[model samples]
Target chain A: MSVVELARPIEKARATPKGPRRRVTAWHRWLSPLALLVVWQIASATGLLPERLLAAPADIASTAVELTQAGTLPTAIGVSLQRVLIGFLVGGTAGIVLALVAGLSRAGENAVDPIMQALRALPFFGLIPLFILWFGIGEEPKILLVALAVSFPLYLNTFSGIRGVDGKLAEVATTLKLSRGQLIRHIVLPGALPQTLVGLRQALGVAWLALIVAEQVNATTGLGYMINDAREFLRTDVIVVGLLVYSALGLATDAIVRLLERRALAWRRGFLA
Target chain B: MATRLSGVARAFGDRVVLDSLDLVLGDGEFTALLGRSGSGKSTLLRALAGLDHEVTGTIDVTGSVAVAFQEPRLVPWKRLLANITLGLDAPVTKAKEALAEVGLAERADAWPLTLSGGEAQRASLARALVREPELLLLDEPFSALDALTRITVHQLVLELWARHRPAVLLVTHDVDEALLLADRVLVLDEGRIAHDVSITAGRPRHREDPELVALRTTLLAALGVSPEGRS
Candidate 1:
């Protein structure tokens, strides 16, 4: 019998008992968050909570609809997304390329790694003043800020991932007589991919953070610009809407990475869900 | 001869592992090497497999050499069939045939991590056999298996070896395992072959047979273990 066939009965047996209990726990997981939202809504309706400090959920929802209909929200989303995408592409590419250069050869490591390590130690946000002075308060500084923020996580993860590839597998490659390029392609890079994906996820997160920080400074567009405009007008509802959009975008990107992980790492059986 | 090593010397800093070790392997011959824990069994095997180059020696092999390590060493990312065909220009049918030979045909699409220990080892063997090596080096591949699985795999290996006629050198610690599977057994000690014995018994030989039992005692003695369990 096939191994899968042999394993079927046991899997069915374990799954049956866990199925209903899992559903119960999944619902329970959302209970606290839902309860908090209800309480906040009630407090807003009863006038126990003031709108200036925090807008009610109903107010935030209505503001979200108004902004969406007025085309402001959509435009801001589009602008912010473009910034992140371009920055991510630039930074992610640079990170992977640098990681490959350092990971693949001793000379590459000696030439590139020490400088990267030193640069990584400086707080990335601290570079904003220097960036503004260097590149001006245009899209250049904003995008470059995001790119710089995104690159380090990817570089660190991909580099370590390449180094962490099993040496035994490398020996197997040698025995199989794989060429140096083939060895890197088949053994090194694929083995390093899981960590690189981790780096990608972190970079995406940091890209959004960097965009927000960069936008807060002398900005003309994007969600941060919308929030800055909302603050001058004391529109707590609009500010909350902008923050909610940022969080939703973050969650959406994370979900994309999770989907990619599921597809790419399906070979890793028994990994936690 | 399939392989020959002359005056092979290997040392790890000050400690000598293989001191002037000389050995020869006949074509299609099955040899079992036994040794105490630190007796350079793996060192010699690694040297022959071309994995260790620091050794000073004249070593020659007739054709391709394939090694199956103790852990199977199948790339965990690759499927069973892909792993078998790794680095080879062979067609998919050849890898499929090799998997079938190892009794893992149905698991050709399965990931390496999903396989049981025995199944993984069989896949390792399939990988080695697919190359059709002139020399097959097994570095204690079966030691990680449970007893029942080990016996089954032992039979499977013998069957494959019989068909392929590869010059097989199996490095193992078990005395009975060596006697059961090998035509010739060599005991390694302190960096050299301390003793060599030929097993002339027929196929499907029993452990209880007077000849094998006597040879086992002698082999055990050569490995510095008393037959009666006394020091």
Candidate 2:
């Protein structure tokens, strides 16, 4: 039989529609959320929902624009972005290095994996009080906190990814007379990459969470600091705007990782959805 | 001689898989090894391929060896052409030529996951052939293919073998496939070659030939199957 004949069934299965063919436009997803925002705005304008409790969407938007023009919001965002970038770099590098050491050799795994597993068991956020005492309320502790939170997911995933490489492929490499370095470069690392990217996505998510919590506790200037300063003045509009910015940053970073996944894992398209 | 194995023995725990086996293949010879389930056919092939280091004996191959396994185990991350040239230190043009030979020239840049089973098997064959191996070990490579695809691949393998003149050792369970392809058919029993027969007939030998019909019955009886379609 021709290759096309053999592949036709799989193609048909994938092409078959599972449900109703009604086309749902992209904006349909936002319909309910937009309606809720409208209801909240009407309530705020009618004085039913007090400004002390929460800011209306319109008020939050105006506050965001005002802060942007005044350069306060931009500065806060810059500081927060810098902290996450530095922390992620440090933690990401450490995680990958450790995973390589542990995953590649038996001696490395024996020396490193036990300690890592032990350390990973502890709730990382619980280290905040101890961190503040040790590093003071400086950028050291804040950046370190984000680094700590970011490292575990990457280390765990990368280690498992490396370990999970197919033994069959390794055998094939051996039969092909691949040198030691070539075997690792061509087979093991590439095999491990899909899982490593998954770890990256997870690490990024936790990095942002760690930064927000760290800034909340003892930040002199950042989005978290701005929110804290607004709390004293009861500026709910500014607080709402800061919260929105934090979520937007998280979503934007996630989208970037998704794009990277698409590019790196293009080979996986026909194998799975 | 292309390859020789003397007193090669392998055992997993108390179960002996290969019991002091001795075999030889002439240069550019096509040999088919047949065995029932658990008859150590794969063990012997693995030993010759130098993949089973625990096989206690001497396995001397004159030159390079390559294997195309049943699964066509291509690295999923690599394109077809890259898979063919993996670790071979060959130019892209050589790999492209091999792809063209396998009728996969247009799929050189395709991901392995996207290829159908037959196409992937052909790519696997290209990968092995690109090495220009002196001994090509095929471990049931065509067993997973449909009958028509198997026939096509069988033809392709014969064509490649003719052109490259590589000594081929095909491990298979199909009696017809062995009779159709090999210069010699060997049946393994009790971890040793129990039946070794030579097919001296010319190329494109007829399955319905009186001599082949007689040989088939003899081989079937040797495999402990009755000629009357009984067990």
Candidate 3:
């Protein structure tokens, strides 16, 4: 006999929609940050907040402008960005390849999954000393550290994503007589994308964290080195500028991924409806 | 025969779903399979579609086959037109033609999730029909719709079947549906055909047709259900 149709009462409930929510005005999101900046400027003007403890927003901005003029801040940012790009590419590629290998075959999964899971259990920071000892405090250790940090989250997420594809959809592929490559390209990968994007966002965050920690341990370039140099000279203004740059970079990368998600998953209509 | 299966047997860990079952369909014939749930209707359909490989049978199919399951099973990530033409060697215009045939020509660009149940099933039917298979398997494709929508879909399927002229195996348990749609109806019981009843009633048969009503009674009785309460 035919199966009973599942009643989606939730769709009906959603149709009887409520009034539109109160929209946040254009300036609302920026208001809090602007208010904090004004407070910082006032404190610094009154000399109530010491520069050694916390540099004022104005001083930090001036320091950033001076550094950019001297080419220090721009050079550091360029170097840091380059490192992140290289590390992310290497790690992301490896993660995707490994995920496909494990996701597609029982033999590949049996051979690879356990070792990766064991390695994943090790804290990323714990590898610092070993990395330094092996790679000798050079660019190798720093980039490798970032790559390693980026790989695990992407690998886990991609594997789970591939696994999470609907079996019924796969059956459709088989009934359609789709070849293995066609099945992978048309069905499996597209099905895995929503989960894989979740992994990507997480990996990007972890990548920045790893880069920060790696550069802090030993580096002569990049944002972390600039912060380290500022600490040595007690120039809290330069340090605050470096911190803000990091935050801005983080925000920018996150925004990029969110945009990608919107474009790629336009077909998804769940709560966005 | 457009499709033939002989001594087909399928089991899951010793629980036989289909046991030495044999079925044949003539070219351009509309056949309906009726069975209670778990009586192996889907199992047989899957075996016929070559989706169930572990079946022990010698099956001979004359040409390509396409299937529409109870669910629409359209790829959620694909547009309706793309879903219809997926893996088919047909051009975009053909997909448009199939959509027009299914009365969903305007919805070709819409997402599958955006369509209601009946509309999505129409899209699914379009997907199957675009292939122009010699055998078309319908695993209760209209069972999910409301009664009114089901009648509309029934009419649509009859129209499409008349145009395509593919040998159809429509798996359903509704006696009136079988009387309305199929030239021949088979009742599956205990993993075998318990009754093979052919309806000679004229085309466009109504639910209230005297011959159809009698056939429904006989079909219901063969299904081991009393016609008194149900009719």
Candidate 4:
């Protein structure tokens, strides 16, 4: 209430609008990538290294266009995306079931959790060899590898989400005399969905990364395979083109999830926004 | 037995919050729980609402029992109408009716976050009302509101209570609040019913009337605060 106390906060509020303008100088957000591209082009023109070692941005763009015309680009991307989708679904469902079991029953945690934790600790990429041996180097192994890569994120998030749900809300549910199933459907699921969504997005990202690794080895036609094949022929242009497609796909998928999250959480807008 | 809790003794570790407190909320009586902080008023409401399991009591009630938490814990994800309708298995036309009672029918579609504190509390009241509860447990229902807001809400609550007339148990720290509302005010001090004061004041009773003033003095005295200069 004193003038000194009042003045400081008032001054800060007045000054705060200027802070972002100063901090986020226009080029900081939009121009850094364009600058990097310029440097890349300049380096290619300098020719200190062979053209194979460093593909110019223009060369990658041209290769991308050629691949698009041939129809290989979209097909590779589609196959990779489909595999990620199926694998994420398989793994995500099982993770949710396990999270619920562990959340509801203490015995389930004691009995099943240690093994799950141990499996979670084992590098999913390392499991590729075991999967290859068991299911053979084919689509099944690749799909399983994608699933294996994704499962931990889903399980961890789902489990923590269940654990982290407001006990106060659960008490509210109980006071209403809701049945167990009703409690799960109305209160528990919605309560956990926010965090579970975070897990789902994270799993999708990991799955996309894993799909690349899975497809790179063996009789596969995917962006990953294209990159690996390009590597053998030393076609840096194609490799750069594949990396761009991979990164773009990952970015686009995450953007979609972000949009869904925003829409799903609309009711929370009044409080959190 | 419409609503009953017998031989109820609730303790938290070494602290006995409610001990051997046998209570029976009659079929249609409004009972106000008055107590100081740590007097286990909220605890008793929680027990009756069946949210607390630590209590050793048999709470028997006819139909559903709905509670309005002290903080108006409206489901943040639900729209105002949806939050009210959440507990009803039988579609309640009364959801809008309840919202109207709380003067929030206009805000039926608004997210709870957009609500003022009073509005949020009103929405919570709507939620309990929609359940058509046989017993309604209110824990410090108006304690969080400003004095002006509290008065308005109190009038609204009294009107709604008149309509529904569920066996109501309201808890509050404010002595005057307990006095203004209930047919009978029960004061708890350290887990026991230290004083049970019956306010024989009629509805729309004037606060400055000699009898009601005397009764207020009596409650203040019972709480060990002398009504000397205050009166």
DockQ for every model, please.
0.63, 0.82, 0.64, 0.68
Lowest lDDT 10-residue stretch of candidate 3 chain B: B222-231
lDDT of 4 at A200: 82
Best by DockQ: 2
| Each model's fraction of native contacts | 0.66, 0.84, 0.66, 0.79
Clashing pairs in 1: none
Per-residue accuracy of model 4 over B1-231 as CA lDDT, tens digit each = 567777788889899998888666776677888777788988888877777776786777788788988889887887888888875775656788888888887998898789988999988888888887888888887889998998998998888789888888898877777777888788887777878767787888678868778878877787778877673
What is the Å distance of residue B140 in model 1 from its true position? 0.5
Global lDDT of each candidate: 0.92, 0.91, 0.89, 0.81
Off-target runs (Cα >4 Å) in candidate 1 are A1-18, A270-273
Count: clashes, candidate 3: 0
Off by over 4 Å in 3: A1-21, A24-48, A269-271
- Put down candidate 4 lDDT per residue, A85-193, tens digits, no spaces: 8888888788878887876668987776787899988878887778888989767887888887777788888878877878888888787777888778878878888
**Candidate 1 per-residue C-alpha lDDT over A35-104 given as tens digits, one digit per residue, 9 for 90 to 100:** 9999999998898998887899989999999999999999999999999999999999998999999999
- lDDT by residue for model 2 over B74-159, one digit each (tens)? 99999988899999888999999999999999999999999999999999999999999999999999989999999999999999
Candidate 1 docking class: medium
Considering lDDT, where higher is better, how would the candidates rank from best to worst? 1, 2, 3, 4
Estimate, for each residue in B1-231, the C-alpha lDDT of model 3 and write its tens digit.
Answer: 568889989899979888898878899999999998889998899888888879997899999999999999999999999898788887899999999998999998898888999999999889889999899999999889999999999999999999999999999978788889999999988888888888888878888888888888888888878888862
For each candidate in turn, the TM-score is 0.95, 0.94, 0.92, 0.90
Error of 3 at B165 (Å): 1.0
The better candidate by TM-score, 3 or 4, is 3
Candidate 2 has an interface RMSD (Å) of 0.7
